[model samples]
Target: MGKSDAFKALIIGGSVGGLAAAHELRSIGAEVAVYERSVGRTQARGAGIVMQPEVEALLANLGLSARSVSVELRERQQLHIRGKAERYRAPQLMTAWDALYRALREPLDDVCYRLDSSLRHVRVEGHDVTAEFPDGHVAQGNFLVGADGIGSATRRLLDATSRPAYAGYVAWRGLEPESAVPEDLLDLLSGRFTFFESSGMQMLCYLVPGANGELEEGSRRVNWVWYVNLAEHDLPRLLAGRSGRQFEHFLPPGELRPEIVEEVTEQADASLAPQFAELVRLSDVFMQPVFDLPPGRILANHAALVGDAAGTVRPHTASGTSKAFGDAAGLAAAMEGWTPRHGLPLRRLEEWEAQRLSHLVRVSEIGIELATRSSLGVPQGDKFFASD
Candidate 1:
């Protein structure tokens, strides 16, 4: 819609995608309200994003400098199990999830964001849409945007058939303070992307802006992710947190069962390089079960899906964050051409869905291929070697 249009947007899930849609839509003159299920600030419970141009664009559009929250690396190195290392010149920017989330959220007005508000139902009547919350509050808008993450309630409400399929592996991730890292390990990992790979597993680490977006030498953090293959039956035990609660997606740091944590430590000591083993031992690690959700129809009448709500490609693509922001941009671009005078942007949404679905499919295929090549045991063919 144009700047002169009277557009009201109701957004579900106030995380990156939701907040991004808020920014993009607002720039085009839409009044936006974001509803988040979390009562307090939402933690991504993950770390380390390879900066993408689209992500940087979103930050730039918000008047934030990417350099303020990112660290630049000059090379990629692979540390072998036997201590031999292979290196390549590859420059990239890395940032922490907390840093990006904080930058995006800080500028959003408190009145436009609602916390402790879980979506109860979505009602669409003619050209208008309404979002009902558990508290019996209803919000009406010209359109509804679903920017929820992988286990999206909005996706369920729109297309019950689309669901996240467990990818038969889990990522053990952690962030260690630079000040706490051993001097030798710190010097070894400081300005390069380091990785180690073995049968059915891969581990990588890089520097990221630390607590509260601090980028100073001693204040930064080393972000690492280890993707390990596991049997489907073992998932239940691994996902069972210390409180005896079974988590569907991930266990926050310190929530992992003590025994599970011990097992992972032992595995690292036994199989990983000495440096990586020590890194794992020193950090408070967390676990995230990987899953892939293929794109279904992302638009239903005046309601639409963005980010993981539409599709979830594997993390191997390193495009999750970029994809989320891209969805918001794509949606905004589509809507920019239409106004309320033309009624609902059904045709416009269809065009956006077509373009987005094609991109999601391509990225998902690339992730599957990368997973197989990295020995994660995925059976996909070498359809492509590109990324989003």
Candidate 2:
């Protein structure tokens, strides 16, 4: 392929990482197209997502500036011991995952995003890559990026041996309207993110501006996530009874076991102070299983993986989005000024892979440690949030 030839870049997935990659590639003049399995305009599928400064920087780089996004910039994060109401603060931001995705998607005008097109297979030969879809459609690109997430089809095509391993826990998340919560609790949760921990279970709560960017009265919403230890065998059964529509992404509201729900409610009622109780009682709960994807490198001709497709860390550090953004930026930077025949700059891919894997390993370690330590009522050190 000639240098002047418009390079066709096919991005498999339209989530945060995939959309960011497409935008970055397009900004640099690549002919970009995204294939998302879900049909229709994407909305907040899961509960909430925390967008750290590093992740925000990538969004700004891709022209999806933070100013236009409706997210609660959490200047501080707090940790609350299970039986104690006292909390300590750390820095972060809280926002809905769907809101973030929509913010990124809105800025792209030239890119073609095809929804309902699930990837069936990727045929890679030399520098040419052909992505086949389940609908009997095929797209050929000079390069292919597998940003399809944890259960990535692109990863499957590139490295069939890769699979997600469970971390022996599940995370339940949900959003509650602020008005439903009492005044005192809203005051405590409104300004900062809060975390609560206990043996075998952990819960977090934070305020996010409502869909309209208002946290006042009935307009604001509070986001909550609960992580609980679960035996691997019981996961499918726990998730099975929910309606198929509700089970599409994370667990839907009010689907967890009544006993577990009652236990959590009772715990929050007893342990959390009046300020924290309102946030918990007003919470519209949802649950999800947490898993850790071990780090591994994928080296092949004309193909690559990024974000959760490459590996995943637990959400404790709130670094998943940042890691995905870093991967997108690094991969885009690696592909600069390259032709199809020349293939991906091997040295560049190597450097990008090394940097990404190192960061992921550190983040994963922190996540595992936090999962164990938070349960012990230990205060998280500030060093965990420092950049490598």
Candidate 3:
């Protein structure tokens, strides 16, 4: 690698973290390309995300307006089963994953993003890296980033031993359009973050931008997530899709077996607060088992891992998106002032890894503590990802 060589970055995983990295690196004049495994845009994945400064910075850097895609939130309330509510002032911004995705990707041309490009192999030669795809396509760049997420193939190249550990619980999630929400339900859920906590179960709901990032009153969505405790042995059964094949990550909409849906519906009606029970009953739902990945090395040769690829902190931390953006910002900053380098800047990469790994360790601990405190069935020694 010569000082005059343009910094060409190959980013794996086209989700929030990877796209954020592309924008940040591009702002620094780096040529970047992103590869996503999904054949089409992931319009339905992910739910509500609490606004963080890092997200705002990423959007602004990309020349996109965050407010155009976000909703202002004013308070947090605990909704009791008896319909009583406990409220507190907690101002924040909330956005949907799809809205942010559309905003970040709006500026990038198709040439820079490859859909359906699943990574099969990665080869590192000095400061240069090459990514091989299953369809016989190969991409080479000055550097490689494993922003592909928790199951990142690039992370395997860095440290194969680390994997996402199950958190002994699964989150049942749904989104209901404001237009479709009953006026009473909207009255209770609109403009505020509401929670319902009980023994081994927790539910929360908030408003997020609606279709095509619409922020109007009638176009917004009521996003809810219900975390339910599940014994480890019962996880596979719940993760099994309609095809009878078990999924390791999540059960997307319409994938849950009919019986499973019935069981959850019954549980919601019996155990959840009246408002939440109605919300769950009225909307189609999906399930994602919570998982935590203990911090580990995030770099291998010239390749670096970011976002969930580095470590997956439980959702209670509310730091997943922030952590992804933080990782992107840190990496971009590390590579910012480097003049033409002869080889990979091993020391700088190490510094970024140290900072990020430290942050991940702290966040992971917080998630565990919060989940345990919530009585979500997380037992001692059950914090690591189990490899089948």
- Maximum-lDDT candidate: 1
The CA lDDT at 373 in model 1 is 86
Select the stronger candidate by lDDT from 2 and 3.
3
Assess every candidate by TM-score: 0.94, 0.84, 0.94
TM-score of 2: 0.84
lDDT tens readout by residue for model 2, 1-388: 3447657889988888888788777656677889887787643435667767766786677666554454454445455544345545565556667667766777775578899978998787777889899889899988888887887888887777878877776776668777777776666667676666556666677766676555354676878776666566666655643344424225656666565466556755765444455456556666666666788874457777888888998888787777877888888787777766565688988988898899999998888888887552123311110112
Q: What global local distance difference test value does model 3 have?
A: 0.83
Q: Stretches of candidate 1 above 4 Å error?
A: 1-4, 377-388
- Candidates arranged by TM-score, highest first: 1, 3, 2
Q: Which residue pairs does candidate 2 place in steric collision?
A: 77-90, 170-289, 170-290, 171-288, 172-287, 172-288, 173-286
State the RMSD for candidate 1.
4.4
Instruction: Encode model 1's per-residue lDDT on 275-344: one tens digit a residue.
Output: 8999999989898988888778988888889888889888989899899899899898878755656676
- Model 3, residue 24: C-alpha shift (Å): 1.1
Candidate 3 residue pairs in clash (backbone atoms < 3 Å) = 3-340, 165-385
Show model 3 residue runs off by greater than 4 Å: 1-4, 339-341, 380-388
Per-structure clash totals for the candidates = 1, 7, 2
